[model samples]
Target: MKKISIIFILFLCISISFEAKSQSFVGLRGGINIPSVNYTNFVRGPIVTGFRNEFFIAPSFGVSYRNMQSEKIGVQIDLNYSTKGWGQLTLLETNTFITRINYLELPFYLHWQLIGKKKLKFFVDAGVYVAWALSAEQEIANDVDLVENQIIYSVEKDNRGDFGIYAGAGVSYDFSIFILQLDGNFKSGFANILPVNPFIKENPPISTNQVPSVQLSVLFPISKD
Candidate 1:
């Protein structure tokens, strides 16, 4: 599956390069992420809460190309990395655990302009995302120290890949030389690729989860004509 996704991304890049003969832009963006985990069982509350609270502002950067200079629609491909996680205390006394999940995401979305030739234009985007887990770690702190005593409840580092749907809306101002944009996006996952270890089930179903994000970016034109 990983190989297939990588190939798909490469194919998209090639296709975009061929179509965007005179359109290309590179930019840098920084933003905040509010991510929450969802579980399959509706009968129970989320296995985790306040997962989004643990995260601070995360930074991202990407490049894009518009096929036709005057066209109001185009395709965009982005590569972004995000840091997100949560922590919790076990039922046992004197034991606490923290889980950190980091990911590298690739999103390909169709971009549409909602307003015509003004300095400020409204836009909407819809796309698919493939995320790879960089790492998952847990830290344990306990007052009593024993040779075989482990404060960490479960260290399942199996969550590796996720597929999600993404949608966003934003406004952009195009200067003769550069463009600036501010956007907010949401992503939800439908599959659980988390690896199962001593702490979690091998196939513990992970349901749709929401990841809300906001970004500010500045783009430089490679060709304005």
Candidate 2:
């Protein structure tokens, strides 16, 4: 976690230093995410037998700094508050389980302009990110059982730090003052959030988060002067 923080800070410093020479923009972005977890190499417990895992809807918002090095090339960094998780449902038992994990994330991207040069343009970006877990919660609700609905917070099963790679494509319209951007992005985490599983004796279950999102941003240009 310390190393991740250091790297992010260093990137911010470097980006700020280039702001004087390059074309830069500061922006606010917000989005909706469809998040899911992939669990593999696991020994399924009795509690998991009847449930099917599905994607959960979540929110993502952030501030971004972008520096354009040239007409077709740029770099961007974002600081975001994001949520990711999965949902499980069992129809016969009328039971549902949902997990929500909050994270503070820093992502850096290299952007490539694909089409157009003036007011309207199409672009693509590929990036890597580091994130720290803020909190995690799970909810349990059942209609068939007499037990009351419950919400539980657990850190025992969570890995506090995560890293991932992502890619995106979007269109941007420059209004001479502020740029309005719309993008679709997909993220795939490499770190297994659930690092320990008692059910599997030889190997631990690999559980990673996958999220796809649509985002909108409004950016104001920064003057070199």
Candidate 3:
């Protein structure tokens, strides 16, 4: 009877140790993002519409901390850099107008794992983003002159930056030392600092806007078992 009790206690200790090891993980992630922006003023007419229909790719980097509560659920926090933009076009009888807005953004999201076991895990994330308009540039081309005029727009009071909400879903594959993730996310702005035309008393004719983005990241774990 004494021997049996000692063996049982030893087995319990081993189980607890294994459980603690599986509870925590830390990793680093870096990826490329293909981003698209939707603007409020995009209308088809004499003026070219939509915030620059062109799609651009940017680089992203992030760090993640995850705590697993059970086999099927976990909590994760990630800090990442995201880039977005849009363009505008104006067609004049004599000249054509093009305007572009670029942003460098920082986002924080809460991650939830939908399926936590096995080599593949699926998850969803939601969060907020604070973005700064890093730069704005414009170009004008004259039909008759055969010359293009280039100018960079300067932001004043109206360029107070932008705030928005973001949500996304992704899947991740775990390897011994690294992990791979693929995700898609969208953001919607609640406020705006639209540019003003002298003829219009109210600036930023459009109020709300949206941006959609897709990302692929390679993550490396900092902690080793």
Leading candidate by TM-score: 2
Best to worst by TM-score, what's the order? Answer: 2, 1, 3
Instruction: For model 2, name the residue pairs that clash.
Output: none
Give the winner by lDDT. 2
TM-score of 3: 0.60
Q: Model 3, poorest ten-residue lDDT window?
A: 144-153
lDDT of 2 at 96: 76
**Model 1: runs farther than 4 Å from truth?**
1-22, 40-70, 86-98, 138-157, 195-204, 207-209
Q: Write the per-residue lDDT of candidate 2 for residues 1-225, one digit (tens) a residue.
A: 446545755764565465444688999999998987765433343333223565668999999998887677778889999998777665444677778988898888777888987999999987678888898887666553533222222566547787877789999999999999999998888887765657553223556778899999999998644
The C-alpha local distance difference test score for the whole of candidate 1 amounts to: 0.60
Q: Any idea what lDDT model 2 has?
A: 0.76
Residue 112 in model 1: lDDT: 76
Give the count of colliding residue pairs in each prediction.
4, 0, 2
lDDT of 3 at 107: 59
Worst 10 residues of 2 by lDDT: 144-153
Candidate 1 residue lDDT tens string, 1-225 = 446545655755665555433465776666877755553321123333221113333344454544433457666767777754444343443454444567787778767787857688899987678787776655554543421222121224445777777789999998958789999998777555544344443333443346788988787776543
Can you give the lDDT of residue 41 in candidate 3?
Answer: 41
